[model samples]
Target: MSRYTRYGGGDPLAPPVDLAEALDAIGQEVMAGYSPERAMQEFLRRGGRDQAGLDDLARRVAEKRRELLARNNLDGTLQEVRELLDTAVLEERKQLARDVTMDDGDRAFREMQLEGLPPSTAAAVSELASYDWTSQEARAAYEQIKDLLGREVLDQRFAGMKQALENATDEDRAAVNEMLRDLNELLEKHRLGDDTEQEFRDFMDKHGDFFPEDPQTIEELMDALAARSAAAQRMMNSMSAEQRAELMQLSQQAFGSPELMQQLSRMDDNLRALRPGEDWSGSEEFGGDEGLGLGDGTGALQDLADLDALAEQLSQSYGGARMDDVDLDRLARQLGDDAAVDARTLAELERALRESGYLKRGSDGELRLSPRAMRELGKALLRDVATRLTSRQGQRDVRQSGAAGERSGATRQWAFGDTEPWDVPRTIGNAVRRTAGEGGVSGRVRIHVDDIEVQETEARTQAAVALLVDTSFSMAMDGRWVPMKRTALALHSLIRSRFRGDDLQLISFGRAARTMEIEELTALDARWDKGTNLHHALLLANRHFRKHPNAQPVLLVVTDGEPTSHLEPHGEVYFEYPPHPLTIAYAVRELDNAGRLGAQVTFFRLGEDPGLARFVDSMAKRVDGRVVAPELDDLGAAVVGSYLGSRAPSGQADYRDWFGGRGFWAG
Candidate 1:
């Protein structure tokens, strides 16, 4: 085996970063009111790793190809041959004139030769090689031309060969030949499926310096070589017919041997047969200023091709496609290790969302939030409420009042008709202490009715909450759609999770009003209708109050518009703009009925519509309700605060009195 010396220092490899952090960031954005699509785009944009670098590589490749085509007219080696010939001819004339011993016949012959030369480049090159020369400079220049031609042709097949073969040596040629022979043999064995992993290892152990990519498997090595081979073919395809012929002729002079050309041709054929999927016929137009030869230009084109593939894979926007479909290895090659990490993290996040039951497919074959997701979203909203309450009240437990539900801090002696659960730990401690003082003989301890202790629990009043959310087209157009849904989900979650005794009904009013389950409401898309039927919504709230006559009725109305529609007899909807008098009367009549039923009404007014403000204020006054105009960010907290306040003791003047007349509820 020939010893090979590799050149150039490459970049140092860095440790891979975790992708989970990126996924978490995306999820947090989604929870904070951004759609999943928008959140993913934002995360990628700010996440530091992008396709910008790949785009730069693509541009460089195009520039290099253009540079090669622009200078295609003049071959570097042929130019050198002409200049050396001129110098050699001039030096010969100088020596003949200085020596006075030269005959006239000799001088005449040389002058004729110099003056009358072949016009064709190939003929001139042949004549010059056979000419006799007296000057050593002329001979050395001629030799250098041959070496340059050989190296240039080899450079067309291999990148970085020009630098490596600058001063040609017999040993370097031998080493190259050996490496090519071994490579071809390995590829041939691979094609036949007769090569083992150890065989590949042994081959690389002997000639590894030639392949700097350090491929670990035969498949990897084949892929790398196949890409380069395809690029070389593409470079030829991009050239004009005349340029192609000239390049092929020049390639024959590579390494000053026909054997080298034969070996490369065999390697190319083997690669094509083994990896036929490569883009062998693809070509790119070059219009850049940087000069690059055919080999370097082809390498750049390959990089650009890889980058285009990476861009498509990283987009993650195809039909029926998910993050898991992204190709991480290809991403790492085109962008960097960080991009691969980010992609993997996104895939994991999507899988987590699907597998953990946070997201599920609906009957329409679209991804929607599952019931579990609604509960989680609700919990998240409740946590936010707790945090906001803590910030204002300096930290206090937000507890729900229930009658005989759980053990309380205070205890009383067991009484008849008392259904409160006993504080087992405290009851046992009391019994033990009493028995210790009595000094009872030890077989078993006796418990009398007088010794039993029971926990004292407060009786909590059950409230029936009907949440009326305006889902008109205006809410979505004005960006209040998400906030409204969030408010409803939070309130629903609060009632169901904290106040088990409360009956919560969700009623959405657009052109009409209807009741929806919690899951249906959470997965509901924005409406595109124009009417806000507050009257219909109010009518539904009154009916709900009628159904649960014993429970305290609390109507929470969230809307961004005044009553533009109402329901008529026979289940027909009447929609109008500019405050219809009949619609106002219908809405007021329903509110009065709710008020007559002793329902607590709270109107959450969204947006800055003056007409809506005036109407909501009038309605609140009519029904003895409160009107709250909170900021979009504070809507959830405001609604939850009102709900908690409604559940306060009946003697409290209003919901505002429960919060000490501070915070969002005071408004």
Candidate 2:
């Protein structure tokens, strides 16, 4: 065993890493305009810890290996061997022809030596090995071929083996020979079913220095060795018949002995028999420089194949596929432990979001929020608003009250003056039981007036809420777009969930004003139009109030700028910068109309523009409304708090007092 193994205890594997945080971070970056691919790369580059990203690294390693194979000449060594043999044979012929000290017997002997050349390269090499060469150059060339063959063969089995064997001593060569002998013996024993864990351990203990990967089990060792052997076979398969023959002959000269070649051949056969699943017959056609060698080329092709499989597994863009399907072990092998963890985490986050119905792919192959996501996002925003409100109000929980009062949760017989909604299920159930008890009346189950049940509710005033959000280009340019949308969603959620009796209408104004459904409003992207038509927004709010004349009108306006445009008689927008006089007049006229309808108005101004503050303050005063200049972060809370205050017993008076303490609004 190595000294490090003797001194060290095996370190524990790292705990699984969470990828949700990373996914969320990357998603936010993507939403902010970065591409998903680029965002993920940046996340990894910044060392953003997660799971499941090793496929990318594996692809890079595969590419690097390919480049190494393309640039380096692997087959040059074999060519050199053939050239050296040819030179040695040619020099022998020249010596025989030029010998002046030769008699007829010597001439005959030299002629026989020249004529006895073997047809096969291996036999030729063997014959030349035994010959007493007359030329020193021929002898040196033949010897160098043997040394080169040994280094090249070893290099095919192990990376950097050739460089390590450069200028090797006799001791190094002996060690290599011993390693090969022991390796072949282990393979033979394994093939015969006589190999044990202890035997494997003993082999590694004796020759551990040669393998730095330090595989723990015999299986791991076999897998490693089998892959290399298979790749070497594939390398030969990829070469032309002539090239293949030359290489096979040259390999026999490895270590200057046929024994090493025989041992390796047997080992390859044993490995192939034991692990038949390996791609031993696979071959890749490399189209680069002619100097491409068989050593790194096959290994790189194998890596490329692995990378392709990993890439397919890691791709999350396929139809209805989630990240959970990725093979974490393969990912770790390709990238690292951290990448696997990241990928796993990302997969989990996707599964969670998908299963929970927060995100989904649209028909256009783009990710968009589902209806559930919209509701969830709204609730999350509302929670933020509630927390902020509670903090400001000395941690007091805001009392949620409906204008139509709380349900009594009990059923009572319907009366003529009862304004409560009917309990349909209970009423129908009572009618059914009565019909069954009456007996023989089989035509229909008649619901009598006495059987009608109305759910009792406390008496409360109903409210009509209109949320006006500015979606002009400036809102997005000034970075208030998302916050404005969030505020509207929070207020919409607060009313729908806590004040179901109240009617809510969403109005977005940019060059013109229009009403939108809650879903439409939530998913609406910021427009690049150049208008903030508050006049048209208030006009819509007044129309909504008129539709529900009995309900208290609550007009909540969220904007970052003053009115810059107003609707004309022909339905076209007349836009002008620097506060158009007609636009101001049109806006004031709408605010007056809203005031006449008893609309409780609140303007949640987003920025600190002096002109906006002056206009909003004057507008609030003119219409007896509230003007709140809230920081962007507090926009949601401000809107929600205003709606809650408006729903209180004293209505606008209570809202004024609530904001009075916070100094958020001027009457």
Candidate 3:
């Protein structure tokens, strides 16, 4: 082994900042690797370009590939080679049977019709039929697909199976649905997704064919994705729990002290003492039981974008039911007069919940916020911010030097904090290496204008926006909880990472209102005891902005419930479902205050409410705000749009995000 410099891996020795860059520089290396995420992350963690940095990496890779090819006299470039590899020519040859006649020998055969084989299988068979098994193409073309597709799909009923899985015949969908329902019901009863092997076998015996027989865990999902589109799958499976948690915990440990740990310990005790599965914890009233079984209570909304996914994950826990709640309390539930969750798993869940800060007390006697939870929220926001700022969509480059246009007049002589943009490449090289080996830049090294490019800065005013989410029970009426939570997570990510300067605050209202960190938003969907507290939400937002008056203030309200809770003069909380005068009055007052304070209020209503609309219409007249009736998927874009007004020019606002990279997410 000569001194080898390995490059390009999904879990690259050093991951690139951007996926594209990773593909370009170490893509070949990535193809050979087992852990793409690990390789890519590693590549990036080593001073690699983030997603935005990919373009630069791409250019560099192109240059490097060209240089290497010129030195080696290789044809085309590395990418072309990879594309050829993807063709599966060799594997295709092996599956096809060779014919001695000219039709199959000298002449290139047309597409193979494995009358019943899958398209992929048919293609594989065609190759084998086109040449002798001894041919290089046949030898190189591995038997991978056939092993995956199996004889039924390949040798016998390939076409039918493809059509069945593809056309999604009723039987196919039914199978999947039944499996999901079984999982969902189990979750409704238990909190886990697995159980004894025999029980698993029975469930699988019923729905095993719905999914692939092999690779049940999330790991399989990654493999399936990679097999389809190596690049996209690479995107889908960006980080692992181990990596994310590692980074998350490291960051948490750095931020968390003994006080924080104690604060974290209190959440479970409060939850357990409140009676099992009851509204005693005040979570249900707060939209806690939204999509996921946590019910969207103390957890945030961004976590569960898929109720189906949540159900599946929790089905293991759902294997049995707890008798502590009202439903099972009567019979003491069969199975020895108690079907309660086993102490081992219950304690495990409790520990996880507490350590995660969903349940925490710390020095506070009541269930407030946990430091660990707060840290996660902060990290969530940070990750969200990183993604938004690095998003490759709107913005083109990450060259930040404040000024963008001609560098003739605007850029002055080198001044403190003024970046060298004229010769950007050099500027970055210098700046990045400045704090390297020897200490600092030597003034003796004269700088020239060529070494200066006024790093183009997109001029846009920053805004402070607060996303006020409704914690009303109505929003959770149809199990719309998953989408809502995912929306929050995506939005926070869009705002913080993309528009770092823009101030983003999250507030939820049910009985009372509270400002939550980004991490808190993910777990908020489980809050179930819901009644709209629009007034308090607005009031809370108004108060939140008062602390940051200088920033452009805007309120983005996401609600599916009408005003039902509002603060009263008597210091008592009031609740009314259909349009309460006091609630409406309080909501309007808060809006009026926002208008006076020059804040734009935008509402994305999930459900229809005449009173809420009338109130919004009433408030719109006084203040600059917009209302949009939105579905869950549209939340991320809508909030991002509000942040970047419709009339705003090319660079009015920009959100750049680079996701699932390593070290950034590593412990």
lDDT of 3 at 374: 36
Candidate 1 per-residue C-alpha lDDT over 480-567 given as tens digits, one digit per residue, 9 for 90 to 100: 8777777887788766755667899899999999999866765566779899899899888888989998999999999999989999
In candidate 3, position 171 carries an lDDT of 55
lDDT, candidate 2, 1-667, per-residue tens: 6454331111246444445465555444443444444445455434344332445554555665476456654366555666888888788778777877868687788668767877666667767777888778778778877877787787677655777887777788888888989988888888888989998999999988777768898889888888888878887887778778878876877878777677678778889988999888877665555564445655555565565666666554466555566776766666567656566655655555455554566676655556665565565566567668766743333222122456735455676766668889999899999999989377688899989977654335689999999988898798887677677777877666556788999999988999997656655665788988988888889999999989999889988888999988888889999879999999999999998999889988878889999989998897789998888889888888888777666443222222222222210
- Greater-TM-score candidate between 2 and 3: 2
Q: Residue 83 error for model 1, in Å?
A: 8.3
Judging by lDDT, tell me the better candidate of 1 and 3. 1
Q: What is residue 654's positional error in candidate 1, in angstroms? A: 13
The TM-score of candidate 3 is 0.37
Give TM per candidate.
0.69, 0.56, 0.37
Q: Which ranges in model 1 have alpha carbons more than 4 Å from their true place?
A: 1-34, 37-41, 48-221, 236-246, 258-276, 284-290, 319-380, 383-458, 514-525, 539-549, 566-574, 579-598, 608-610, 650-667
Which ten contiguous residues of candidate 2 have the minimum total lDDT?
658-667
The candidate that wins on TM-score is: 1
Q: RMSD (Cα, Å) of candidate 3?
A: 28.6
Model 2 misplaced regions, further than 4 Å: 1-293, 304-333, 336-352, 361-366, 393-404, 408-460, 651-667
